[model samples]
Target: MALRTVLSDPMLRMLALAVLLAVIIPVGSQTRPAADLLVSAGVFVLFLLNGMRIARSEIRLGLRNWRFLLPLLLWVFGAMALAGMALSSLGQGLIPPLIAVGFLYLGSLPSTVQSATSYSALAGGNLGLSVISAALVNIAGIFVTVPVFFLLGGTGSEAQIGWESAERILLILLLPFVIGQIVQGWTRDFIARHGRHIIWIDRLVIALAVYVAFSGAVEQGIWQRVDASAWTWLGGMVAVFLLFGHLGSWVVAGALRLPRPDRISFLFAGTQKSTAVGVPLAAILFPPEIAGFLVVPLMLYHLTQLVVAAPVAGALRRAG
Candidate 1:
């Protein structure tokens, strides 16, 4: 994973463009209902493809490697979950309350399957373990992140999750994924034949998620609320989260005495966060305005991981 490779990523660029559009031309309230419907449909398609692409066999095989997978899960959701709680608690009066919540959500997310696996491979990792571990973590995330979030003080007037939100999560995110898994045996060839199309469609939905989420922030005057000082504070906190993630993953993997290749897989698997899961889940869990605000740290951390992982991968490769 070269720095330029991450920098040249069109998806990252599209994310920026989505934010720009959100700032400049947010969806109006008159169109909110329609936009909401469209975004929901996109999310359904996004997860459906995710299920189709990731094979059930991989998960079953990876589950047998508890020695490796268990530690990765605990480090990602447990240690990092506590880290986010501390950071969010410490953020009181220093940043906007909701911006701090971003830290909690960011910390609890699953490692990104694509970038983490790619970086692991670049660093001479166990690519098989990297792929399956990432997939398993993400699969766990759809169920884990929200409940952990709520239990960790994510519940209140601003961030409440009611029955309606739960139903939305099931219908929009879970049901489609189940359908994809059931039909994947039939659709495998079609998905493989149209891999390029699937990739673009995935990216478009993610971009639209960013657009829809950020538009609410724009409508709430995110720019006005997040000033120079707040931006500085936010930047500092994001850096802390990044440092904690990468360094913690490396140390924990070493302490576990994993072989070098397995250690490398754990390294990337523990550090990265998935906006694809985090954003849509946020939209369902919180109001669009609050979801937009909550995801700020997550979006920042997601890009930073791309930049940070390149060098880490290079270092690991050289070390290997």
Candidate 2:
């Protein structure tokens, strides 16, 4: 699963390189605070840019299209999250507790924008809705994922969202986003001028966060804990998740009597998990070592989605 994500996307390849760098030069405890500060700044900028670029009309479009959007909401956060919880419950003795918690984390995340959008386009899906769905969920995940994670018994006492964490989220994530929206009208040309380059900002932050998170895990002996059997278990469990994600989304959308393009949007939006949202947020929410353990399932699910999405999109195209 790890190798697959690394192989599938250039951005993910950079992320893989980040993991390698973490392994080689793990951030010591002394340096972690500085690293955390940098990551927080990057996340603030990333979401700020997101707010600037995403037009308000698009958000309203997603909201008014409730017939298609509501089921998508249910399948993504509701069904997928439940699946992760059930699996997490089942894997108690079968896997490490953190990795089991990782399932719920992975399930709780929003869809990746690039993959879901690209695959939706390839499959002759509704491009506008796909784009909007991806963006909305990515934005919404910041607000939704952690609460849902804790509600589902993601961890014990150490895992609750302390007031400190909530305040940080509001300050870093929410505040910047609101500020960006406020200034977007004035900064339209500035954003348009460098919009393409802004994605690098997002990628760099995710990479840095991934590096720091894994550095903590390396410090905690991640490699030693994840032995041969654990790898095997991880592979099988992730496959089960992949199947459930793609197949279940499709089946549920069809059962909802969605037309093909809308159904395709549902499939793509429901199936993919965003490292963009997941890693940076995890860095903020969990301690570095715990964040590292939690992202393992996410890393695998992320790249594997790239591997499977092309073929799935092609199949959908053919069926259409």
Candidate 3:
């Protein structure tokens, strides 16, 4: 049962895949270029699948819960960005500037859908609200992230902000998503029938993206520049940020007088960040040199959220 549970755990599987790829893939192999291209294609397909799977009715329902959704959005997009900037300024001496930018990038991202909804359902939360909230935030993030990126001083030729870059982003990310949504009705039944398998495909793409990102970083002497102490500091900072986010959500939920289940949905929705969106956006928006560093914080935050949310979800289930 333990072995089966381990095998079935998506978080564990993703972490294992990342570790394996990081260890096995050489720093500058001939396959690096191919892997990079594959990562881009995989990300496009991942988003396409997302567009197809998301229910429009759920998104509308989430939007209708403006009282809950508005505050959550403010915290995710505003407070987190402010916190990241402050941390970056304070930790400049301790960690690299690029890594700080990574934190800012992580902050600017939207909440995740799959795990947030799954955990909320497990915890007897308002699963429909969770679904709507996650989907709405991510969809809104498609437009909001670029402006937030510039606000955080992530601007330059290399940072790739401008009309051309915007067009490229639309073509690569948004266009396919729109196309998928348009065709979703035809695909919905098929998607429902093979939902579990499709999720694995998403995970596989994400793992491949991580592998490609880290491989590039390894070649650029990321390990040499970021020592053990720096990693420890980075890890500590991420833990604090996550804890504060979760706690803040709980406080806000209570202040809003949210029902227990809605509170659970709001807390999880506000606290979680989307790795699926973040990794791909980093690859598109940032230069290769900094992209790897940009995604490190995101990957760390993703893992930390999974670790923290699992037990919390279990506790919530028991309490309910």
Candidate 4:
């Protein structure tokens, strides 16, 4: 009956956002830069607010577990770098670099606190390890990503360094996390007291972000070049990449004689890519057309990985 009730249910909320995005199709044809900037800023707020719920202690512990953390970090960066090179070999030029950067960002990002912890728990991983790993990646991304962008030649060249695109991303993402950590020291009890209320707000923010992002893309006329066939290839490639990434992580884990819990952590967290982080970064770094094509694969992959990984994770749990 209530607006929050209507928007806080995950399935219904996501569907509602998707429909909102669909309707934005017509509105997008005429929206101006001011409107687009406003929408982007809204999404950026969600990014910051999401970090506020996480405590600083969780982050500190996530960093201290360097054995598991270090290897996973290497795997993420290595896989992304290789993916870039491999795609280039297949004759995909600008799109490959964009995608590689997406994958790299994927690698460098902190694990989804809820999703990673849920999967790790379901698949029998070390819970503390999962928490720490997620925190470490996110914290590291704040520092690592800036240097990475420069090292990968994302400086004053094309994306326009003077515009402070990289700085904006860091400010939106990293600044919030650090602030939350500082606040957590004093407000831990208060935060925990209102945790249930916070959950609904969190969902609302995510739903709004999804709506804004899709709408902004529509506003930019990104869908013009996206055809049915293009979507199909994107879907197909995502499926292939998901299978390969999962298997690759599994093989590496087993070869290293990792424990069962560690292996499961490696497989799911390592293989599942984040479109939330990837889409915004792509939008910033690439021309509209190039970003559109590059984003197609990630969106498909994001959808398919959840569908496919759920069953696979369940099967693994049953076997164990």
Kindly provide the TM-score of model 2 when superposed on the true structure, using C-alpha atoms: 0.96
The window of 10 residues in a row where model 3 has the poorest summed lDDT is 1-10
Query: In order, what lDDT does every prediction score?
Result: 0.87, 0.85, 0.79, 0.56
Please report the candidate that would top lDDT against the real structure: 1
**Pairs with steric clashes in candidate 4:** 62-132
TM-score of 1: 0.97
TM-score on alpha carbons, each prediction = 0.97, 0.96, 0.91, 0.76
Model 2: lDDT equals 0.85
The residue pairs in collision within model 3 are none
Error (Å) of candidate 4 at residue 303 is: 1.1
Q: What is candidate 4's TM-score against the reference?
A: 0.76
**Number of the top-ranking candidate, with TM-score as the measure:** 1
How many times do residue backbones clash in model 4? Answer: 1
Q: Identify the superior model by lDDT, candidate 2 or candidate 4.
A: 2
Over 117-215, each residue of candidate 1 has an lDDT whose tens digit, in order, gives: 999999999999999999999988888887877788877437787788889888988898899889999999999999988889888888887888899
Evaluated against the true structure, the overall lDDT of model 3 is: 0.79
Root-mean-square deviation of candidate 1: 1.2
What lDDT tens digits, residue by residue, belong to model 3 across residues 155-223?
622444778668757977898789889899899999999998998888888777776677667677788
